[model samples]
Structures are given as structure tokens and as C-alpha cells.
Target: MFYDHADQQAEAMHPNPDWTTTPITPELIRGALDLETTQHGVLPHRLPARARAQCTDPQLAMVESQPSGVRLLFRTRATTVELDTLPTKRTYQGAPPRPDGVYDLLVDGRLTGQATVTGGNTVTIDMTTGTAEHQPGPPGTLSFTDLPDGIKDIEIWLPHNETTELIALRTDAPVAPMTDRGRKVWLHHGSSISHGSDAASPTNTWPALAAALGGVELINLGLAGSALLDPFTARAIRDTPADLISLKLGINLVNLDLMRLRAFTPAVHGFLDTIREGHPTTPLLVVSPILCPIHEDTPGPGAFDFSALAVGALRFRATGDPAERATGKLTLGVIREELSRIVRQRSADDPHLHYLDGRDLYGERDFAELPLPDELHPDAATHRRIGERFAELAFTTGGPFTGHNA
Candidate 1:
């Protein structure tokens, strides 16, 4: 459905008398309908103001890795149609200024054109008028001409910038589909570790890397300080669709000292129950946390050891009573044991459910060889190592990944 700049111009000049009177039909709509697309941003949940400020690159500012193409659904009332692209999320310093120039245009998910703005003007394409203009302030609109005699879908690729905000999207069509069936989605939830806490590029995050490695789609639900078995998050997971799913647990639970054994057990169960509502038969993997010496077997009033920072290490201490430790209170090691037990119990009845000890992703041996930078999140090298190990363990056919046996 993409029109070249010249084609758009020619169509604009012709002024078909039937253009506005063309009949509309659903057959022309070409992308996914009733779907919601979201970005994990640079980090997971809880986007801090400072982190938002650092997203200066237009491409990296908003959503990353848009599916190759999407269908633009539209309705026709007049001789021509105009399309606009805007940012959905914004970072604030003071007042919002005009967006910068630079953008690509796509029709039916294919690159059909490009545009450059001057000052903060919007880019407009008028097919019937056979003219495209860059209007100052806000996003400009694109007009399409030469009525195809039905509803249509068009997609626009906007420049990425920290300041770019998705204000509005309009089309002559009645509906738009954002994704296609070819995209395989993998929904994942974990701690800040899964959120790209210390990863390098927006795309280099472990989930992104793993998705590339596995050649599948991804929906990362990792939250920063808020992975504490919240019902709302679990409900969000339950409502989303996925081809595969994973929950990296333990470390956050231990670090934050959210719950003890009794509560943690049922909390895990409820979380699984919620996800099962949406993905009843999809493959689901539950993982424990990687090794952190201070939180391994200890309970916590976890504190940042300033001395360790000087030496490029972090020391966390368990504040639980020694007696509590004996009884197996909240510690990474304890959480791992409980997670294993829970998975075993659940898997007996749910064939698609499985468990992966977080240690399998990164263990004592791996840590000893390359310790974490601040005793918490892994460094770039570790992210690569973890990503590789995850791909090997979870994605490879005939590997340890459950159901591959069949």
C-alpha cells in the first residue's frame, strides 16, 4: 500500500472524482487488529526521570524493534487522507518544544517514503492536493490519493528521540493493525537484571539478545524495584499473549526482603495461576536468581557496603536471626529451593510448566570467574554470558527445555 513520493504527487494532481465516494471493505485492512503494543523503554518498570532524560536518540527514545511491517486501517470520507505520527511517552526538563526533523514513512509496513522537518513543524502529505508540506510545531500529516475503493492500513516510522512523544495518530481508515502473525512473541518477567539494568545498548539487553539468538519475539516485563509478586503485574501477564514465557525470580525477593517462606510459597502459586489464565498451554519456565555471596544463605537488611564499591564490589548482609536462617527463611538459596519445589509440584499436573534453577543461568563458577561489577547487576560481559547460556538452555531444540522431548 506504499506510494512513492512521485506517485503520491501524481495521485494528488489527478483529483479522481470518485476518490471520496469509493466503497470501503474490511478485506483491505492488512495488519493485526485489537492488539496493544508497548515498550519496555531502556529499563523495565518504574522509569526514573533521569533515565528518561538520557534517551536522546530518536530511534531509541520510544519503542525499539517494531515488527517489520504493520497494516494501516483507514476509512475514506474525502478525496484525500492525511496520516500523522507522534510520541506516546515523554521526558520532561521544562516545557515541550517542537520535535526535530528526520523520519521514515511506511505503507502497509513497508518503507515507501521519507521526510525531514524544519524547526518543529509537522510533515504533511496531501494526495488530492498533490502537495506535501512541513508545518511548524507538532507532527505533520500525510495525505493519500487515488482511492483504492476500500478501507486501508498505512504505517509511519517516526524519528526516535528522548523528547519525541506519540501525541496522536490519525488515518482515513477506521482501524489499524500494529502486528502480524509472523512475529513470535516471548513474554518474560524478572528483576532489574532482566530489565537491562546494567546492559549497554537498548537492543543489547539480555532479553533482546536472547530474542535475536532464538529468532523469536519478546515482551520483557522486568520491573526495577517492583517485581515483588504484585497482583497487578501478574494480572498484566495474565492478560497478554505469548508463544513462550519465563519468570526469573528469587534475587529480587531476597534483596528486597519482601516475604518469608510461608507467604512466598503461595505468592508464587498465585502468580503462576494468573499467568495460566492467559497461557494455559504455553511453555512456562520459572527461574531462581543468580549467585550473590551476601544474599545467598543469609536474610537481609541488605545494605550497600561503600568499601566494596571502592574495590568494585558490593556486600549485602542478612539481618534475619541466625535461628531463622536455620529454619530456612528468605534467602536466595532458600528461594531457589522453594522455587524448585513449587515447579515440581506444578509440573506434575501442568505438562507445559517447567523450572530452571537460576544457577543454571549464572552460578558460583561463573561468578567466581567474573564477579558482578557492584555485587548486584551483571556487567556487559556477564550479560553476554547469561544471554548465551539462556539461549542454549531454553531455546535450542532437544536441549533441556521441557516439551522439546516430545
Candidate 2:
């Protein structure tokens, strides 16, 4: 069935015998943590090989491969471009099919075209049943033609929330890797907020928006629902090439109740320790959780608010009792306090390190006007707000991320 469908599409592409088919290698893509070659094409893993081996959590594996902030950055003189991809589209049983992942094409840092790939595959996930079924289909090609071409920097941004397997790239003219424009690479790690959970598109994610505003390259490590302070993630941060780095912590820990303050305190220390190992003097900012009213005082292990779901909508509520906070259990309010303390204490010895209360990005008053739609993740407008705030706070002169006096 796969071959049968693929052959039909191939015939269309073959009609233009002069089209150049180029192989996609690591050089062609940016923001992907790892690349694995497959018979169909290349599978880009946002987590590196070593990191992948350490954790066997299916959730982590799935989210990282979504390629939210990853883009195929290149320079080409072509007037037309075609990309083949096999995307694993998700369905929630009774829920309506999520919109197809969007491919955003940018020329010279400006939006030029948008596309969506058909065919490919589908993975239906039944949360109620706790099972998933994969149905394979042939790769589909997305074509964009007619452009004012005279050497342009092109960025093909992958879908924000879909697992995509890139198969091939074709163009009317030759393509080459885009030359490094001397932009500082900002490596960021955070929760679903940074992952673009409800973002309009991949390029609209907070990190991506901030990167655009700050004139920096983004390597997003914002894994959805899997930002548990894993040792492997810390090591990846330590090893990655980055001029500026930020770690957004706390929300995932509180929502999952993965550990108590006792374990969390040391885990935060250990995570920073590992990162400091590689870039001892890098500008590393430890950011606390953003303002989430649900988990502000109450502890969590957030649960789906079934009442809201019954009306064909998804909503979440903090399930952990507020009384649990009397013990070592964690909450956003508590985590913010601890993170600020830890950074203040650490910055005295390590000047390059900094502390940023995530509330500074999106706090109480702002929540009244721009509420988090899901009571958890920020909406598109909030991402823009956070991105603008981050650029003003971190990239401005005299900021921690900007060059400062020792």
C-alpha cells in the first residue's frame, strides 16, 4: 500500500525530468539534536544519541521528535521547492482530527509560503484506553513554486506538534547550506510552555519568537510533558554548542509531582552542576516557573477536568491537594521561591550564572487580560508577550545574557 501510493506521487515529480533531487544530511537542518537515516529518509531526533539511550519514556521520545523549533535552513537560487515527508499525525479517538502540521517557508527571514503534507501516516492515540495504533501511508510532497530568486536564505520550518520523517528535497535549482551569519546560538530548555503547546505555528513558539527578536539561533530543548530534570537532559545542555543558555524549571515538576522538595533541591543543584561542567563561564540563567494560578498555592499531579472535556474541549485542573504543601510536596509558588534562592546563592560564586523569576515573563496582572487558555500553557498572544519580554530582559545591554563586566 505504501509503495502503491508513493509510485503515484513519484510519477508527478518525474514529469519534470530536469528537477534536481538532493539528499538531506545533517548540514541541511538546524535545531535538530540528532539525525538518524532511514530507508524512507532522515528521522530528526531533538534529543541526541546519548540522551536517547538514557531515558525510555515513550512520552519524551514522542515529543522531542516533533521538531517544533527545528528548521531546514539553506541558501538556494531555486524558484520552486518540494519536500517529501512522512508525518505521524495524531488523533484522539472520539476527538476531532487535529489540524495538519504546517510547513512554513521563509525567504530572507520573511514568510514566503505555507504548506501541509498529505498522505504520510497517522497514529491514533486513545488516552482513555491508554493505547495507540500506527497506520503507515506513503510519503507526500509539498510544492512551492514561483519566487523572485537571486540567492536567498530559506527556512522551511517543520510542524510544531507532529512527528515528521523527512524523506527528500527537490528543487529547480541547486541548493547549499546557509552560511553562518554570526548570530549567537541561544540554547533553551523548558516545559510545554516553551514547546509551543497551543502556539499558532512552529515559528511562533516563545523561544522561536524570542530568537527572532534577539537575533539569535535557537536550539529548543523544550520537551512537552517531559521536562523532568533528567540527568541526560542536563548533560545534553552541557554538551551542546551555545553562547547563551536558559533552563526553565518547576512547572513540570509540580504538575507531575515527580519529586518532593528534598529531591528537587538536590536535583536542581545537580542539573546545574552538570551544565557548568562544560561551559563554566557561559551565561546560564536559571528561570523559575511562569505564573500558573492553578498550581500557585496548590500542589499538583494535574488531572484532566472531565467536566470541561465532556463539552468537546480539553481542560486541566490541579489535582494535588493544597494541604499537601505542608509537607515537602512542590507547587509553583514554592518552586519559584526555591529557584530564586538557589540562583542568588550560586551567582555569588559564579558570576556568569543568573536568576530570573519566570513570573517576570508572565505574572499575575497580565494573566487577568491574557489568560492561559488551558489553565496551564500560554496562548499565542502570551508567547509573543513572553518573547518580547525575554528580548528586553535578557538580550538588552547590562542584562545577564548580554556582555557584562566581571
Candidate 3:
């Protein structure tokens, strides 16, 4: 997959590799396990006996399974490693504690072991008593005591949980070669709204959910408080190879008040131009932001929300002319119109370029039905709604996002 000049440079600098054929030597296997332990912050959930057996060509597979449906995988060899799971932080008002569940591990297609994550870790602060107390509970760990030699495959199974998440998978060994499977690649960039700010599960983030719904591999470049039209980011997009691509714009710029209308329009143009340099005909969808009342028509001073201060939570906000905003001066709606117009003009020569109103994903009607908790980021339910809408609008049959065909 060849991209434009910027993309070619990025590919050369950080080439994506195939990891399937990479031989899993003992050293490599140990390195993989160590990497997983360190980067993933948790041990591999399960490992079958065959995973411990020595083999010339070792591989790990994860097939959907149930009870809890937690899958597991293991590297061929093992070494002493410590794994830990981080607790989830409550980022929203009335957010509930995350649930915990069990995950199983399989080696070479057979169940080898399992570990339980008991979710009851509560440290209550009693203002009346002026004391903080810890509730003791069973800790979570998976240690394989005995094993046969010649291991080859590993898998992991995680039941539903609230407190812990499978943020990443890591291996100390070099990445294996790319598998010979056709996996759709998704490239997306956006604001903190896309960064899983108020989402419930790690996998429940809108982009993650949309990927699952569309069955595509994802490269999320969603940065918190930083989707402000950086040329480097556009260059990054230009350099990456993707079967499909989307850019969620507008709200971040309006909320940040990063640039005036004069600058915003040209920046948007330049951003799209840079991406086109690499992906001239890729199915590219540019989306505006969801409805945000405060910053809808107003510019922002980029201040943090003090409302949560009463509850001891810090939230970011964009400040601007409320009166002018009320008169419909500066809003995501305004930007959406401009962006659509730009796409329409540019698409005359670039038919592959497309535009979608953010309202299509979440409109004023929906906002009235399910309002955002912090006036900015959506709740978990809203994330699910947005993901489903995106998948339906962009990935379903006859949808706007036909990927390679588009």
C-alpha cells in the first residue's frame, strides 16, 4: 500500500510489520511474556498445556468463547514476571464503580488455566469519622506451577469487568510478520471526545466500538486536548496506510478558540490537502463535532469547568462571547457548514472525498433525549450510540465508507 510523500516517509520511519511467521524462539517467547507483563499491566489470562511445550514455530490464537468469554494467549517460553491491573478512575458524575470478572487462558487451542479478578476494592473515606479504611480482599494473579515442554500457542478470555481493562498487549520480542489475513485498517483522529474521556469500558470507546462493529483494525490518533490542526498530525495521516480514514473536526477548534475563522478555514484546507497528498482516492470522511450548547456558537477562552469543583473533579471548557454565540455566530454548526462547503468544492476534482455532519451521528434531538453529562464528552451509553451510528452510516453495505472500493 503506497501513500503520498509524507506517508511514505512515515512508513519508512515506522513501518507496520507482519508478525505471523516470526519464529517464536525460547528467548523470543520469554521476551514476549515479559513484554506483556510490563506493558499490558496484567498477566496473560490463560495458557493451555500445549503452550508450554517446546515447538519450532509457536503462535497464539484468540477465539471468542464464553462463561465470561475471556480469551487468553501465551508465549512459548516463560520467565518470572509480575503483572498488575490498574484501577479505573471515575471521570463523570454519578459514574458507578467498574465491574470485575474472570479471564481464562488457553495454550495451543486448549484451556490451560484461568485467573479471577475480584472487584471489591473499596477505600471509603468517612468524613464523620475522619478516617479512611481499606476493605481487604483476595488479590488477582495467575501462576502456572507445572508444564510440559514444546509449547506453541496462547489465547486469552476476559469476561465482563468494570474496574480493570486490557489496555494493550505487548511482547519483548520483535513483532511477528504480518499475518496473511485481510484485515481492514482504520485510521481516525479527533478531539478528547474521541479519547474515551467519559466512556465506561476501554473497549467501549466510540472508535473502539466502531472498529468492532465494522470489523477493522484501528490506529487511533485521538489526543486529549490537542486536536488543534497540527500539520505534523496531518503529515502523520498522509504517511499512514489505511483502508479507511475519518477526521472528526470543528468542536476542538471552537472549544479551544485556537484560531479565528480566517485561520480555521485555511487550516482545514491545508489539513485535507496534506492527507490527499498520500491518500488521493481513499474513502475519506470528514465529520464535524456533536452538539455542544456552550461552545456551539461562541468562541472559547479555553477554561476548565469549575462546576465539578464542588465534587472535586476538574473538567475543561471553552469560553467566548455568549451573546454573539446565542445570536448564532460561533458554533460547531457554523463550522460544519464551512467544512461541507470546502469538501463540496474540493470534491469536484476528488470524488472520493466525502463529508458527514456530526449531527448525523448525534443531533439536537438525540442531545435532548440523552444529554451529555459534562456538556462536552458523552457518557458510555452515548458512546455506544455514536459508534453504532458511525458504523451504520460509514461501514454498512452501501454505506458511505466502502473503504478500498470507495
TM-score: the better of candidates 1 and 2: 2
Error of 1 at 188 (Å): 0.2
| Candidate 1 local lDDT, 231-319, one digit each (tens) | 66677677766678889987777776777788999999999998899889888889888787778877765655645544544443455
User: Roughly what TM-score does model 3 have, to 2 decimal places?
Assistant: 0.61
Tens-place lDDT per residue, model 2, 1-406, is 0112344466544536787788898889999989988888898888998999988887898899899889998888988888888888887766656888888888899878887777778888776776889899877877777866699888999998888998888888889987777888899999999988888888888899888888888999999998889999999989888999999999999998899999998899999999999989989988898899999999989987767767767778998888888898999999999989898888899998998989999999989999988799998899999988988788888678775211
For each candidate, what is the lDDT? 0.56, 0.86, 0.56
RMSD in angstroms, all models? 12.5, 3.3, 14.4
Between prediction 2 and prediction 3, the one with superior TM-score is 2
Which sequence of candidate numbers ranks them by TM-score, best first?
A: 2, 3, 1
Q: Report the lDDT tens digits of candidate 3 across residue range 95-151.
A: 333334434444544456554444324444333343445554323333332434443
Give the lowest summed-lDDT range of ten residues in model 1. 40-49
TM-score versus the correct structure, for each prediction: 0.58, 0.95, 0.61
Task: List runs of model 3 lying over 4 Å from the truth.
Answer: 1-180, 313-318, 322-330, 403-406
Clashing pairs in 2: none
Against the hidden true structure, what lDDT does model 1 obtain? 0.56
Name the 10 consecutive residues with the lowest summed lDDT in model 2.
1-10
